[model samples]
Target: MAYWLFKTEPDAFSIDDLQQAPQQSTFWEGIRNYQARNFLRDDVQVGDQVFIYHSSCKIPAVVGIATVTKGAETDPHQFDLSSDYYDAKSSKDNPRWVGVTLCYQQHMPRPVTLKAIKADDAITELALKKAGRLSIMPVTDAEWTHICQLGGTE
Candidate 1:
């Protein structure tokens, strides 16, 4: 299965929040960027592995693991006028956004910080280093393996 990295603000939705959700699953919604929406809509698949990265915090890092429990569904928030993520451009007939449901797997004892990742020789070529701010991004198999090892999952 394809591997992915998904970033969320810890204050908005932390690893603990996912772990505590009913069935440990939640819709990965509110992605306003078209490219990020496209990844959720067209590239992600059920059973795909995900690196739960916490961004915009003191130490931006990958803190946990999750799996795609569902894929390629219209984001409900897009239709809710009261929601901050609501999109007037989106419609039932032609959605402009999409999201996936991710099921929590496990949290790392210590988060694998961006500094740590950058220092790792195995992940020098990771897109995260050069790209820097894509909310949803692909993770190479080798990078995934190295990260899991860093998180003490391997």
Candidate 2:
């Protein structure tokens, strides 16, 4: 199965929030970037594993694991005028934004901090390092294994 890294600001949607959600599933929405949107639309699928990364916060890190429980579908937020992610150009007939639903799998005993990840030799070439800011990015199998090991789950 393909692996991916999905970033969310802790304040906006933390690992705790996912654990607290009904059925522990939530639509990963508000992505406005075309490349990020395309990852959800074209590459992601049910059963894919993802590293739930906390970004834009102190000690940004991979805090938990998630599974893609549902594949790409039009983001409902795009049509809601009151939502921060609303887009006037998008519609039910033709949607410009897309998202997937991720179900919380488990939280690591300890978050694998970015600082710790950066110090690891095996993950030096990881996309999370080289690409840095892309909210949605592919995670190579090796990188996945390495990070899972770091999280004490492998």
Model 2 Cα lDDT, one tens digit per residue, 33-141: 9999999999999999999999999889999999999999899999999999999999899999999999999998778998888888888666778768789999889
Candidate with maximal lDDT: 2
Could you tell me which residue pairs clash in candidate 2? none
The collision pairs in model 1 are none
| lDDT tens readout by residue for model 1, 70-145 | 9888888999999999999889998888889999999986789999987887786667787778899999999998
Whole-structure CA lDDT of model 2: 0.92
Candidate 2 Cα misplacement greater than 4 A, ranges: none
TM-scores, one per candidate? 0.95, 0.95
Q: After superposition, how far is residue 87 of candidate 1 from its true place, in Å?
A: 1.0
Model 1 collision count = 0
Backbone clashes in model 2: 0
